[model samples]
Target: MIATYSGDTMGTSWSLQAVAARLSVVRGVQAALDRIVAQMSQWERESDLSRFNRAAPGAWHAIPNEFADVVDAALMIRRASDGAFDPCLGALTERWGFGARGSVDRVPQHADNGGDNRQIDFDPQNRRIRRSVDAFLDLSGIAKGYGVDLAAEWLLANGVRHFLLEVGGELRAEGIRPDGQPWWVDTEVPPSSSLAPWRMALHDSSAATSGNYRRGFTVDGRRYSHSFDPRTGQPIVNGVSSVTVLHRSCMIADGWATALTVLGPQAAISLADAQKLAVCVIVGDREYISRPWRDMLG
Candidate 1:
């Protein structure tokens, strides 16, 4: 029998389903996620990430292995996406009123990217990071995915072979259900929209969805998305509602979902095709699915 458990982390909720695993494993799983938040959360003033962000320019600070892993993946995706998935955009995000400072009705004024101030050099081999300027590193795009993966890792190490794990809306599935069926999940669509949910059967795979509808504020009838274009240092004006990405690593899926969302529909399709990413992009009810998405669904 599988036991279900859930708690909170990363300013969101986490849930798990384990087949033939001890209930006490929940404590270990929770601890694993807590470790990630302790090191990565900018919301926590004392978190390693927060301390690093507040340090002097050119100062190198030691980071935990968990933080380094996310940074490595983020830097790889940033290069692969040509800065569309920049982890170094925390300052821009805050300028757009989406970072640790919280939301605002009026958009904040800032020059575009301010030329090199939003840059970071991470040394994963030494588990350290250096800021070229006063840069804030934000991982809102991918840290939740890492928490999901780490929780699943804890479960696997504790003898759980069959399970599905989730933090916020990001998901990772392993093995099959007790009935020998893959975990079936549906991608989230904007509320009150005429969009159909995209469903998939997941086993040993992960999925993450990024949508403009999740966070933002409306001013003068214009809905400002929390999604900031790192290239422009402004909130993206793209018409995209959401992008869902499927991959073996939830962290990559999460980052790619955000990257593709910033790239918008047509551009995202091209990049998804080139990367062989299984992705579905929704723009005001117009659904665009890549070849990999179609192939994976079939």
Candidate 2:
């Protein structure tokens, strides 16, 4: 029998299922996830991330090892995606009313276009980070994926080999189910569609999906998506509806999903192909699959 447990974290729910059933193990997993939220949640005022966002500029601040790891991943992806995905868009996110502080009445002026990820400095040796500009660091795009990974790690350490771990919509599956089958997941068809959902099997891999379909608002007949282009400080008007990425690390899959969504379908497809990443991009009624992702599906 697979043991299952779930709770709230990072403004979303997290669920875990393992082959080993133990209350102690479940509590430990919950604790591990809670620690991640305490350290990385931008929505929580007392979170380490929030404190870092409000810290004085030009001074290096010590960070938790896990936090530093996520930052390092974000910076690497930022370079790989050519700024399509950025963690330094906190100011722009807030200006667009997508921040922890909530929404505002009108679009704020885009003065500085926020700052680039290059402005932030990371010292992996000491797990320290410092920001040169006034930009607020937001890890919402990638932190939850780390949370999922942490939960999975805890289960593995507890000797639970076959499991599926999910935080919010991000997920990672390891080994096989009790019935000796791979964990299967379904990709939702874009909103307002009558089409059947696409299905994929996960084996020792992670998947994350990013889209503007459910989280945008209309202002004066103009639609503004929650996703913003870090380079322009403006909402992306790209034709792509959603992007799903599969990787060995949930954190990388999560960040790449958002990055590819921002890049739109064509550019996203090209990058996914070049990187040999498994990705599925949905544009309008059409779906595009990268070579790696196609192999996975087959």
- Give the per-residue Cα lDDT of candidate 2 at 294: 84
What lDDT tens digits, residue by residue, belong to model 1 across residues 232-298? 7777898988999999999999999999999989999999999999999998978999999999756
The C-alpha local distance difference test score for the whole of candidate 1 amounts to: 0.86
The best candidate in terms of lDDT: 1
TM-score of each: 0.96, 0.95
Clashing pairs in 1: none
Model 2 per-residue lDDT at 43:
81
Residue 11 lDDT, candidate 1, scale 0-100: 81
lDDT of each: 0.86, 0.84
lDDT of 2: 0.84
Displacement of residue 237 (Cα, Å) in model 1 is 1.1
The reply for model 1, stretches above 4 Å from the true place, is none
